[model samples]
Target chain A: MLNIIWPVFIIISFMYAIVTGRVNEVNNGIFEAVSDAVELSITFLGTICLWNGIMEIVKKTTLIQKLTKLLNPLVKVLFPDLKHSQKAKEEISMNMVANLLGLGNAATPLGLKAMKTMQEENCKKDTLSNAMAMFIVLNTASLQLIPTNVIAIRTSLNSANPTQIILPVWGATIIAAVVGVLATKLITKKIK
Target chain B: MVNYISAAAIPFIILGIIIYGLIEKNKVYDSFLEGAKEGIEIVFKMFPTLVGIFLAVGALRSSGVIELIVKIVEPMTKMLSIPSEIMPLALLRPISGSASMAVAVDIMKNYGVDTFVGLITSTIMGSTETTFYTIAIYTSAVGIKKTRGILVAALLADFAGMIASVIIWRIMSTSFC
Candidate 1:
């Protein structure tokens, strides 16, 4: 999907720039984007490292096990294929934990690990399983309890009530998540 | 208020994790270093993908494609009660995080940060994930070539988030007013 989408973006943008006579602007944007990507990755590096480190500690202490146990009922319902797979369950729960805390960068590795684990259990190599589809929906909808980054940005911009959007964000994300999961379940059921 | 509590949450989580690690008598420091090293490697692996998407998004925005998109979508957005000014952010939210952040920042700058449009943009930004980026990095990490059904589901979620943000903000703003 991305294979087609990524190139199409570049092609469309280039064509649009030429037609609009904004080639110079596109050139500058490309240069700035390169630097921006590097800077953005570096920023992610710091936060990812810190959160992963904390997660590592949590894992070593078996806190993840406890979390998995606590989340098992919900997780099992969402990912029935992972019902007996303790490792996948642990990784998925940890990923959900990171996501709920709004640690996206930290959640990615855990999510990737969970996906890889689930893939290993699947009979088919390339095709996604129903559980994997559900996981993707849940992760992407990502019902965040604390939108730390958004609030931080609003605060930096000097909003009088930076966190005023918190309740609305939570409400919207929950709705998105519920809708996503329902859609995934219905679609996967029909396909099966 | 909620802001103060949320702000303190991260530190509280860190402290709790550390305390639990100590109680469990784990080699917390060594484990942390190992995880941090792994995190760095993951960041490096994601760098090229980030560069490709960022440049495309940057060009798309700078070349006025996004603005053109906004113009085209203006009527639909108005009918949906979403401000036309935030159309670009809604469109970009599912594609790239930084790009959408830039749009949200721009909206907050042009409109007062506390205004209805600004609040909706912020809420939308917070609620939605970058679906394309997440799918790309995650599927590649797992070496999955065929991403069946996830894309549509994720995009649906993004759409839901966008509409919900606008609706939720409208209700909340009305109550406040």
Candidate 2:
């Protein structure tokens, strides 16, 4: 997917800029983009380490199992074939918890962990499993409870009610998630 | 109260996890160090993908391509009663997180945050995910090359979120104000 989109982005940008005489702007954008990515990586480093560390401790105790138990019904529905992959189920549960808490930093690392575990016993090397596809859809739909970052930005901008959008956001995400799950399930069945 | 809860959430979760680990007689410190090391490795592995995505997204944004697309889609969006101010945002939200945030912030600055546009922007920002970034990282980390169905489903979901945001906020702004 990225293999196609990434190149198309570069090609179209250059083509459009050349046609529209915005070549310099495109050049500057490309030049500064790597540094921007590096800066973001640096910012993510501390938070990622902190959350990963905490998650490790959680894994060591029974907390992971408890959390997994709490999320079991949802996880089972999402990845029913993962009945034997207990580790994958646990990581998926952890990732879901992190996402619901609106912890983007924590969620990525936990999600990567989930993906790694799911890949451990895969017979296919390059193709995604049904469970993996469903998991990615769940992440993409983003069923976050409290959008802390959005509220913070609104507060900074002096909004009268920074949290007023929460209810609407919940409505949007729930609908998005349902659509995503249905779409994935449809595609999975059709493909199989 | 919302602000207070958001601020305290992380600290409370961390403290609770630590105390639980201690009660379980687990090697919390050692486990943390190990996990932290893995985090560093994961970041390094993701760096190349990040750079590629950021470069493409940056170029796309700066080339006026999005504005061009918005202009093309203006009539359709207008018919749907979606504001033109948020078209770029709807386009960028799934591509890049920071770009969408910048656009959302710009919208709020131009129009007050309580306005319909601002409200919809915030709702969209909160609900939608960066589908490209998340899918790329997750699939690449696991060495999954055939990401055929995932991208389609994810982008569809983002579209749903964007439309849902606009409709909900429209109803909300009308009823509340």
> Which portions of model 1 show Cα errors greater than 4 Å?
A1-66, B1-72
lDDT of the candidates, in the order given: 0.78, 0.80
lDDT of 1 by residue, B103-124 (tens): 5765675677889999998889
DockQ of each: 0.50, 0.47
Candidate 1 clash figure, as a count = 0
Chain A TM-score vs. truth, each candidate: 0.68, 0.67
lDDT score, candidate 2, position B34: 86
Cα lDDT tens digits, model 2, B1-177, are 544554566567779879988999988899999878876876676667667766776787789886777788889998988888788678778887765665576567657888888989999999998999999999999899987577898999999988899998788667765
iRMSD, per candidate, in listed order: 5.2, 6.6
Clashing pairs for model 1 are none
In candidate 2, which residue ranges exceed 4 Å CA deviation?
Answer: A1-67, B1-72
Assess the local accuracy of residue A150 in candidate 1 as a C-alpha lDDT between 0 and 100: 69
Candidate 2 pairs with clashing backbones: none
Per-prediction fnat values? 0.75, 0.80
